[model samples]
Target: MWKMKPSIALSVHFTVLLLTLSSRGSSPAGKETFSWVTLPATANLTWTPCFDTFQCTKLALPLQYSDPEAGEAQIALIMSPSNYSSNDPNYLGSVLFNPGGPGGSGVSFVQELGPYFRAVIGPQYDLIGFDPRGIGQSTPVLSLFKSPPEALEFYSTYPQNVNESISSFGRFYAQANILGKLAVDRYPTIAESVSTAAVATDMLNIAKALGQDKVNYWGVSYGSILGATFAAMFPDNVGRFIIDGVFNSHQWYQGDWSSSLLDTDDALTAVYDACVEAGPSLCALHDKSSDLIRARVNKLIDSLHVAPLAVYDDSDPSNISFGVADYTVIVLQIFQMLYTPFASGQVIFEALAALEQGNASAIWQGSVTMANDVDLATCNFNASQPFVVGFLDISAPIACGDIIADEDRVRTSDEAKSDYQRMADASSTFATTWYPLSEGRCAQWPIKAKDAFNGSFTQNTSTPILLITNTHDPVTPMVGALNMSSGFTGSIVLQQNSTGHTSLSGFSTCTAEAIHAYFANGTLPAVGTLCQTDTRIFENPSNSSGYTGVTITPLKRSAEDYSLGEAARALAGSNFLAKSAGFFGRRW
Candidate 1:
């Protein structure tokens, strides 16, 4: 959501990088000047130091690309510099990044983990992240309720989850329909402008502002979908792009995300195996065999399904408060923890073990949240619930608006049930709890995108992109990378032999080397290349955590030699997933 402004041209030659647009015709014989950062004078793109170590900038882009006159929207951008000036021989260029929440905030992402990402990709190019249109820090925020009280009222009375009980499925389905209608009713203008295609164009504009014709990018999960869309829409503009944790564009644009979780169950199997290898001392859920452990865990969850556990604080004479730890609430935490198993194995197992012993504090404390359950009795009426931002405001529109919606979508209870069952059949592990990520997300979506691309993803870019995927991603699996790579001829699939969401979720020296080599000099690994991650999951560290009671290891390595696994653990405090915090934990 930005309006383009007229700016100076950039020469792609290594000799003279930055140039003026007026002198384009009289430039030196062989140099080709490209029109970059053509922003209006009112919206000049300028950088300033922010967050102590990073450079921050905001660009005004056309609210609607198709109609430049449709006012403008502000895009918040943050960049971690490569520490090399343009004249320095070490300065390559800039790598534009999208952490992938079709609705994720780049400003917050860069603020939190820019150093880690810049270190991983190499120090020659600047790493940049942005909050997509109508997202965090960006103008025209998309939200259903303006304040905390409204959201609290809705969530408090809403179906806790679709899987809370047999009847909850129907209530949750109706609630989603109501939410879609409410969102569109609240923000139709944003709903029309927020799509993957629009974000792709925004990336091109960002690349131009950075004085580069080709965009150097690293996108994860939903970000991968954004990268693929960029390559397909503007093939010649592609520059050393990497789509890690591949989300099949074919599956996404079709309004069908059922196929993406094909490897979630397999990821769980790996987690269980690693637990057995770690022994009972390190892993709380250890068993002689994976099957035995699975049965044990399933039995606990089954019991919760029949009778939910209630946690009550009756210490105060007059005030007794309670919170319920049900099947859906605990499973949602399990499904999210599975995203980074190396870091969450003990967190999950420990909570489960505590629950098995008839204590719900561990799991309930980590999972189901209350605004002020204990203090509700004495709670001031004027005081509101803690305002926690949710991403569904943007994710719903991107997922629902991008697709073609008919009169017969997720409007009815039967349609929602059928869609959910389809997802469960594809991957039974966390389908019920994780259903909000994709399936039933478009229930009664009221608005349609002004511009949507449900076409082929085939592209022949000037520079080929590198596609990376974990062997067993909880959401976007290996098949997605293969399917995405098929359209881009000459593109190579770099497989990281790791269990988690993406290559960053685990530590792999080989994968790091390949990433470094690729960005440093457009180097491509051999066809059928497989990199093994060095992460040792389910291993207890020296110190236990104050929060989860699991042993926690602190990561403080320099960017030059950082471990992706350790970095991931450090980043657990922030929601690294680009889409909804529903799966990844936090909004940013």
Candidate 2:
């Protein structure tokens, strides 16, 4: 759930990452652009007309693969059908996507950005998005709260997340965790059923039902974990897989998060460097050096941690709606900014500047939502996105359930403290607020997977999957992408030299063209290939950079390359993810 403000209630506006298109247009080919519309439903609701040009349906897969009689879990699905016939020699088949929540909804992802993807990957493949079992629209959703309102109240008033006090941890550790047992106690079977491996199996089954022999896929963030799991579990069935903003699957499988922070500090520093580059006119926190800016920000954080700045409505002395701009809110906002820096990087800088002079508007997502009059009803969440509009506590179990349950998995409050310290060591600006998600989240996780895949990551799949990422991913580091690539022989890592969460987190023509090529043909980007983004942050919105793609092993640029770069330049200075509620997600 990304959009953050000091307030307890949160909501998300779905501008989830896909490339920032020049604008929706015709296919790269000469055909008219495919548009979807709201349509009436069929009585059976099986591959029926839905949301206009799309189709919606459900599949009942076994809750427990080992015990078919145990029962079945219904999987909600949606698809944007391709115009090209599968019989067309160049036509690729069905490509399925998972937006990395371990708990995120694939259905919602497709619903929001299916047309954009149709433009991105061309119209040959039938693009599909599904809510993994136990997630949005999927049956038996692993909800801890009875209703959205109750969940919103609990999250809005969450005491543990507000301060860095030991009591905060003790209270949160004691109370928030009961939901784990509550989950198992209530829906024992379904709670135990939503493992990644089981979902992988469901994907394979989904492809089979769709009459495709092998599954083509695109996954981001935690979706990387799901993609790698599928590749490892069903190697022969792999086809044109693309995993971006890679999560080190090894670390994920081990129930550890320490390794993911290697690039976090670097990412924060980059934002400061960019601010200095932009100068005082554009970047409010600009300084002679990045270090100076960091120091100023750090000093602010330290003072706030000691004594939070209380903001009030000047006319109304009693108004605490903006609450206190403290270390918790400050650092947590940094965590939010890290997801998509171009959309949010300057925000923290300006917020810090504003806070120094007594204003807290820029730093608060809740207040912004309020000021913008975004109906809180639109804030609903699925597993992949943490946009706080609606309810979905299943993220805890989806995460906790994956780790084969062990006594070592759950940490004591003291151990939790150490974990926090360790994460803090990794990211001084973070760890305080982020620890709960990366590691602390598992402290109360209860279930272990019975249908877990104990397979090795190194699988000689039918085709070498493609891996892409931003150089400075706030959550999943680039090294993790390299680490995961080592397992899948011949897998190429195409990086967009930019700071953000994933490939989609930034606009890179070189990277996009590389993706198009990979899907158009099985060609992979040459080793040591690096791409430049078509846009720059904190620049004159009118002055766009015409950066195409770059590769270390240089060759003459083609005419097509220039066109893509021109398209990307059209996107310069656009804050695409300013409201990206979630895709592939914030946590993963």
- Which segments of candidate 2 are over 4 A away from where they belong? 1-45, 148-153, 156-163, 313-321, 365-392, 405-409, 541-588
> What tens-digit string does per-residue lDDT give for candidate 1 at 1-588?
110011101100000110111121122235342211221222656876554466666788888888787668778777888878977999888887766656656565565567667666777988887878876556655666554455555555455457766677776677777777786677788778888888888888987877778888888778888889888899988989898889888877767877767888888888889888888877888899999988988888889889989876666769654578778666766766666666555666777777888876556653424422211223322232222235455677887887766555445667667777888887765777656546566766767777676556888888988999888888888999999999997899999888877776676778877887899899999999998866567666312442241222223544666564444444432324412233211131
**RMSD values, in order shown:** 11.0, 7.7
Stretches of model 1 off by over 4 angstroms after superposition = 1-42, 313-322, 371-388, 405-411, 541-575, 578-580, 583-588
Minimum summed lDDT over a 10-residue window in model 1 is located at 6-15
lDDT (C-alpha) at residue 219 in model 2: 90
Q: Model-by-model lDDT, in order?
A: 0.66, 0.65
TM-scores, all models, native as reference? 0.84, 0.82
**Most lDDT-accurate candidate:** 1
**Which window of 10 residues has the lowest lDDT sum in candidate 2?**
546-555
